[model samples]
Target: MIEEIPSEPVVITHIIHETPSIRTFEFSRRFEAQAGQFCMVWVPGVDEIPMAFSAGNAITVQKVGEATGALFSLTEGDVIGIKGPLGNGFSPEGRVLAVAGGVGAAPLRPLVTYGQADTFILGARTAEELLYAGELAGKAEDLRIATDDGTRGHHGFVTALLEEADPASYDTICVCGPEMMMKAVLGILDAHGVADRGQFSLHRYMKCGVGICGSCCFDSSGLRVCRDGPVFTGDVLLRSSEFGRYSRDAAGRRIPF
Candidate 1:
């Protein structure tokens, strides 16, 4: 078996400005990882946050929180630490329908690039926020876009586009986005009787990327997002008490959505 790598410092090789708010950081040391698995990114003195791979040695970050703000201030040659390509990833098989919202598109990018997905629907607040449309258009057999501001192909939620499509037609449906969005997608897929075909990626407060800490644990299920998943099947999510309803804070306190 290959030796498991531990947390180690890495230098940023380059950065790509995907959008005004989103950036992709490429590291000097390359590693192997599946699409949906995540790494614990340590920002030196700031904090450590879990980030999913956009590539083998790269992470796509959206400037949203304090940890990410610190990440945004760094430039090429800056140092950070990474631990694990931990948690189960999507094992997409056969024809796939991929749906993503906002920065959630980053993780699903690999699936399309590998020719696993036939259709991709990307939703954002506006046209400018739509991530990787040009790159994905050429990769996916059918690429669709939806924006809340009517600035793109479909002027509504991504869920609306999903409803229009044949959910049962695809062998697998992969999704990652805001918890509310994924929850809505699950409901739709359930209505179509294809809930079992869906796979969803979820994010929760994570202190340990190795599942030692219970910070990322799903309510009642005792499933740890850092280990058991960042990706879960539709059936598992449907049964989760905390799936879309609420999430834990840094203190492990439940915060309702």
Candidate 2:
């Protein structure tokens, strides 16, 4: 039976600096979440933000927004509230291909560590921004890197690498990255007549992690990223008019991507 796990306080027991801008905070509590699932992390006296589990008991955080900045300021033994294992996750089929960009690697890390990805393509702005590259290299059967600054492997966008890949070669192609990148990847998959095999994880503004707020709902289909999915199939996303066009801000204002 799927039972709801209530919000509870968790203590940070360890911290691993994954990148200059990203850190993984480990907690004592083991959250049994799948590769694509996320949790609502509450920073006391600050804000609650949705975070994907980077590991079994850790959240890889990039120092970005206010909530994340607050999380960065924290150290070992600091307490935080966690309320999830929420939403659906990727159920890896055969011969999975995983693609990630920037911090999007956090969620896909678990999948890679599970030995799910037969091939993994990772991209970031620079070499330093590539999260878990070393670990992922040891995990995935094949690992490729792309950097915008030419500090590492391919000197271009990750989508450039995706373009070289045969989408139909893999049974499932899971992607989590910047919206524009994912959109482009989706186009590639569609052109290859394998859109059904593509799974894209979306990043949307969310106040409440649950479906009640409706803040994360996109246009047309009105799918809630928090509830329905942070991970959506390429075909479903193609049907949504707002998927790549725009997203709502915290104030419900339409922000074009």
Residue 149, model 1: lDDT of: 96
Q: By TM-score, how accurate is candidate 2?
A: 0.96
Compared with the true structure, the alpha-carbon lDDT of candidate 1 equals: 0.89
Report clashes for each candidate as comma-separated counts: 0, 0
Q: Give lDDT per model, in order.
A: 0.89, 0.90
Q: Please, what are the lDDT tens digits per residue for candidate 2 over residues 215-252?
A: 99977888889888989998898898998889888999
The TM-scores, one per candidate, come to 0.96, 0.96
Per-residue error at 178 for model 2, in Å?
A: 0.7
Q: What is the lDDT of residue 98 in candidate 2?
A: 92
Clashes of 1: 0
